[model samples]
Target chain A: MIAAMTNANPNIRLDKRDLILTKGSEVMLRRGYHGTGVQEIVQAAGIPKGSFYHYFASKEDFAVHALEFLYAPRLQRYAQALGDRSLSPCQRILTFYGELLNHFRRQERPQYHCFIGSLSFEMAEPSQPIGLQVESILQRSVDILAQCLTEAREAGELNAATDCVELAEFIANAWEGTLMRMKAGANAAPLSVFLHQLERLLTPSP
Target chain B: MIAAMTNANPNIRLDKRDLILTKGSEVMLRRGYHGTGVQEIVQAAGIPKGSFYHYFASKEDFAVHALEFLYAPRLQRYAQALGDRSLSPCQRILTFYGELLNHFRRQERPQYHCFIGSLSFEMAEPSQPIGLQVESILQRSVDILAQCLTEAREAGELNAATDCVELAEFIANAWEGTLMRMKAGANAAPLSVFLHQLERLLTPSP
Candidate 1:
């Protein structure tokens, strides 16, 4: 049925696949990996079950793709913010977080903002394919932050003694935690608090 | 069916209920709230299907109770660590995290250590009772930390200018984020990094 449908209308098939991935990302982000079912994704996408299989072999495979779909644009934004040479490295780092704060605030549900963090907690166990994907995405994010910190240190924006790699990982870890609190309390106070404290840590002593 | 089973042996029914809750907590912690099924819990506990409803009204209700069950013991541990008068308040605070780090290390799968953090990301949406329960539990945890920080301030263990309430929330938020990283990396590095950063934050400048 899937082959016949795809052969009849390849363009429609591609559109349906994109639709499933988009909707799947939304539901999975909200409900989590194990919590979401393939049937629900199909229903939400308004596509047939067979189409889901045609687009992806399994739910986990679909999740991997869905994550890539969710992350690709955000990664671009990160590069844009962190890669800008005009701003001081420190400003770039803070600006990235400031923009992220605004992004979180703009969310109808701020708690659902970081799907990667959500899935990391929900699926980063038993060290399966899904877990490895989450680990790699997080590592890449941390690497970007580490690069920014390294530049900041070189420019004398940060303490010369500071360990950029460790600090970057620490910041990322704290940010993820702050996101969890934001979701649990249904408030943005934690994010603001994190920003305040993080600035204090990053600033040079008077 | 539930009423008949309960009437048959009330004591045995109570035991069965406890069994179901215990097993449910384990599976839910590993799989997440929506990912876990009633049948899986029942099967894990070696109980029949009718007994599940006999104990709890719905999956949401079961989850709320399961959270309570998981949290009660941990809360007691926190209280004990935070309430110890023999140590300076700073030592007490550090001791709590030290103990937590050890606990995470002891976990065969450390990613599953913080069930509240996982559930916060998974179920802390406005759609259900589970979210409220998670929110309240997290708040209570934060409150305890705030109280400890307040004591630390009085003891001159923390900076005089520190806002204990906000710092408490930040520490708690950062700790949860650290746990998420620990899970994703499947290692103890995040916990160690959190302890290092948290200690630095709490210490007075030389």
Candidate 2:
């Protein structure tokens, strides 16, 4: 039946589209595109497949859009967190970690394993579009962190020797790697350890 | 016919079992288990499906063994690198990175994305057994690094402030994350940047 129905309703509200994106992101993050099916995504979203294709061109297009959708709110949250005027740059950095940890822990399904990293891993050899999408997100993420680090550096919140761009990439890499360890360990302690170590590194030098 | 063919002659000089695993490891390391098929493995190995089952109980079992086979040599190489008596602890640490970078660059496959990390991303939620195998490898890899760090710490080669265990874990996490970035960016410079930052962190203060 046309390879199963997709959520095909253009008139659908943004909420419905987000719902599809959330469910689709989860499935693709876990089983990957080749392994996931439209039926499964629709079932997870509690929406018909017709509603899905209406919102997306194809599985590949949906995956790209889903990543963008998922990242938008996160980037917004990060920007808000970094913009907090009450907290110092270092304190805001700490708050960022708290927000991320809380965000992941609250998920009923812990499959939001960094869309960029997950898709990059799966699509490295198969889909150039997916890889390009992932790279774009990664670059954006790195850029955001770099901006924060640069602000901190300008404020003298970080060591003067720190290279903002490199440290930003390092933090981004650490976050991705820590996520892997947490998922593989199926325990949160590694994440806690990472944050603890990160805080220790960020603690102002006496 | 069954989902996957599994039969082969037992008397072949080149044990079809070893051949299958060797070829299968190459395929799985590159394409992932779900992304590959028994036919592809058998065809690559020039063996029949019957020959495959003669050595493996199932595809999962074959995967488990293939991973073990692939990783054991790596563990040995790491051990040797960490154990090098010719270099000081700090030098040995740097040597490990040098060796890793060289191996990845010189390999027939320029993209030697760690099999354990790659498979962990693809199979973490779907299969607990495979997940456990990946975890064991990760733990072992970290432990090996920790041992080197401990030796370095004891030898007074690292900054007194560095916690060997935590630093080891950090290094391991950084390396894994760097590999993902390297693959995503299709460039090795990120890895070099990571190692350079790490060298600064690990070097004893003057």
Per-residue CA lDDT of candidate 1, range A144-184, in tens?
Answer: 88998899989988889888888888888888878777777
RMSD of each: 4.9, 6.0
Candidate 1 steric clashes:
1
**TM-score of chain A, model 1?**
0.86
> Best candidate per TM-score, number?
1
Model 2 segments beyond 4 Å from truth? Answer: A1-10, A13-20, A37-57, A99-112, A204-206, B1-14, B29-31, B37-40, B102-110
Per-residue lDDT tens digits of candidate 1, residues B1-206?
56546586777766777788888888887787777888888888888889888789988888888888889888888988889999988888888898879987897766455677777777787445777888788788889988988998888887788888888888887787777777877888788888888888788754
lDDT of 1 at A186: 79
Expressed as tens digits, the lDDT of each residue in A37-127 for candidate 2 is 7787888899988988877888888887887887778777777787787988778888889767777677654553666666777665466
